[model samples]
Target: MEATLKNLWSTVELVAVAAHSDVVEQWDGQTLTRAFHWAQYCQHLFHRFHDNPTIRRVMEKQLQLVNESVSVVFPEHTAVSFSDLSRCQHLLLVGLLHNTKLPVSLLRILFDTSSPVNKEQAGYRNVTGLCSSMIECKSACKVLSPLVEVSDVGADAEVQGVLLMERLEALLSQSREPFLDSVLQGCEGAAEHFCLVIAAALLTRKTAAAQTTLEDFLLDWLLHKHSLLQHMCYTLPASLLTDLAKRHVKFREAYCNVLKKWASDMEYSISDGEWFQASTNPTVSFQKLTEHFRSLSEASPSLWEHVENQLNALKVSDGDFDVRGLSVWGDLLSEIHK
Candidate 1:
């Protein structure tokens, strides 16, 4: 299973590269037959098809036709390859980051089926992009075509939030038990990951209905596990962090502590034309920041709000704010303020 999945990943990588060079207009019957065989024999292996640029473009052009008939006509599930392309993180990231307009409602469903491990890393990354792209696309489309509904999302935010909250609940609910088969073995790391996913959901909140899920997860699910706050204040974009800041005093303290830590940790430069350099590795610092945000959002209710305030203050503050000193974080914070 693993080897086949790996091989298919290699093939998908080739398809991604090919996407830049040429377009495959149509698949002959034989190619279609082979694709069907691959799908039937390797459902797990074929997930990587999401990364293919050519395939995604082809799918988008045929979306209306394929969406209506393929699933039923290909009851053997052969035509799932195109749907699989919507789920690929690398390809999805390109679309999301580069602002490619492709229907990605399938992503919500694809993520539902992703493994917890994948969900924590690449899945979270893709979801972040998906939420952003979906919002951008919806807004642009609403302007371009007023009569058409902008969002075609079927997955409710509350449901998505609940599912994510449950994972954190599993870790906290089992904290007292032995760590034999639990995700709590690395609570710190897991909490960080949870924040990233939660932030993705938070980024897409357009209506009261969408926010209900985030609010419930925050107020009901996260507050009990308090340690998560200290992690988020340092990690997530300040704007996103502000969501939690309005709720928790402890999270506020943690946010201040993280800033204090960052300030104290920088090595003072004395020479002429000097700039500050952090004693801690910048990459590690950024990772820690992400982990902090994830942890706080998963465990503390108000950390996001607190983070946004901190970020905003930093943006407006005078010389005390050394922008270039904090490389990765500075760039991220700059965008949030913009």
Candidate 2:
């Protein structure tokens, strides 16, 4: 038994028990520092005694020690107010961000403790920025899945271009009003990045169901979620889907399916658009879309202009709305076009 881990561990047997709540809570700073010792001991014990199970148990303990230490050293990091964070809060956030080795457990603590500010949309944006900047996308998404409104299509790291896009898709599929608009730009940029990857996939002949994630997200959301038919026919219908499909012709049926669903469910009307407007300014969302499908303009002369014109014409008028840009396309012939 190494002296560093020995004094704290108390038992020679490294075959671990999940640290109890009391053990984690009461363990002082000195004991917590022994975590590295435990990790070191686990490495040595695995080789010396060839005790794999015992070492594995001890490794779990070490990770738990690190996780708990994070909660102790910087308490209430993710739970704090998103708006007007104090210097202490800034320091705490920066501390977590600085630690690249953040575990999945601590990430869960961040989301679990935090709550969205309903009336103040900025709060949601602030938190989303913080999460995206600090937390790894995959870890953040796994914790956020239960919060999603729907998700039939799963994630694909290779296809989405980046792992974050998979998380973004799960987020955008939801009917979460207060946070949806704020979160869409994250999705748009992610969608764009993945589309670029898909474009390259087209060249390599490496396309597959796994590779066509963005298309799958759109189709699955529209098909199974059912909210898209009633809510998204105008914005998500032909404009965005067409450009996405062109990159990979295989998903054209998904695009056509969205439009067809929108047509049949025309009777279900609302004076608003779906999955389009990200913020108070339509330009923000439009700019994001253009960035994502920037390939569209390159593909054809008139295509980008048409999409831009349609988006520009609409104004998010006066309403107690959860999302921005309500006045633009909600059954407006001028906005929807002939």
Candidate 3:
């Protein structure tokens, strides 16, 4: 172990085991808060190690050490505030994100469902909010871009796209209306990132959990948001369309509606939308869709249910669904049901 990682490993191990009870009482508030942020930054270093295979291997060792240290020290409901545990987990997530070989679907679950201190939504939103200004996004994406094409229907790379989309969806679902709405506006670019992040997630073996997460991302998005359905039907080809259609009933109806719209208006397709056009390269297009999909999937079930109820109240049916991609999805869905 290089002295640097060795030092970090030792420090993390010591800090990791210092149970919540140990910190809660002595909490300096500001100091611990700062430490939390510092830890997250360090974890980001591990995230980037994927590009440097040697560093990644070293990071794998250090990561296990750090994770074990934290797990032993924290151990769920061990008198830690949701805030603190979330901070720790969020730090871990940064590390996980940079660990490019991790499965994107697995990472998505870890981000979406793994609420260490009940702040997964805030934790990710805050990171994403800073992603544009932070150089980390560009750096991380460069490393991960090859692993995930962000385009190419049913490609393994899309799995990473799904995970990111799911994590963001969970976050959006939990956010307040105004805040959620604001995120929707900013989410386009953030989604494009994580080709590496998704790739990392995919690198992890495909377990049932991983596959379920993939399913969850697909079902969650299709069932909840029309925007994503709009994106997929227009941009993705038959394979993805078929996967989604086989999974849900409402999506089938919605897909049909989108196809009908495309037939009606050649000038306006989902591809023509600002979000879709952010990058014309298929890779870029796929990244945009992935990001949008993540944002849509990230919505919390409670909040998502509320959105659904509201849409229902407005009687928003397939007739009103004008996204151009819908018909491809419909074609796929129709085949699945058959």
Instruction: List lDDT for all candidates, in order.
Output: 0.41, 0.36, 0.42
* Comparison by TM-score, 1 against 2, better one: 1
Q: Residues 1-338, candidate 2, lDDT per residue (tens digit)? A: 34534432321111121121223334333333243234343333333332345754554464456435544644532321111111222323344445544444544534433543222232212232334444455666567666754322322323333433344344433322212222332234464333334332232233565545544554453345333332332333233345455554434444334433332233322454433432322222333333333434444656556534443443233242323334323333232332
The candidate 3 region of ten consecutive residues with least summed lDDT is 77-86
Q: TM-score of every model?
A: 0.30, 0.25, 0.29
Candidate 2 all-Cα RMSD: 18.1
- Candidate 3 structure quality by residue, lDDT tens digits, 31-131: 33344455564444543443466865665566566666667656641221212222343434344345445444443433342233333443422332232
- Tell me how far the alpha carbon of residue 313 in candidate 1 is from the true structure, in angstroms, after superposition: 23
Candidate 2 residues lying further than 4 Å off, grouped into runs, are: 1-23, 27-161, 164-239, 267-338
Which sequence of candidate numbers ranks them by lDDT, best first?
Answer: 3, 1, 2
Question: What tens digits encode model 1's per-residue C-alpha lDDT throughout 107-175?
Answer: 342223332212233222323233444555445644555454332222333334445544434433322
**What is the clash count for each candidate, in the order shown?**
25, 3, 26
- The TM-score ranking, best first, is 1, 3, 2
Cα lDDT, model 3, residue 150: 54
The runs of at least 3 residues in candidate 1 whose Cα sits more than 4 Å from the true structure, single-residue gaps closed, are 1-86, 89-136, 140-240, 248-254, 266-338
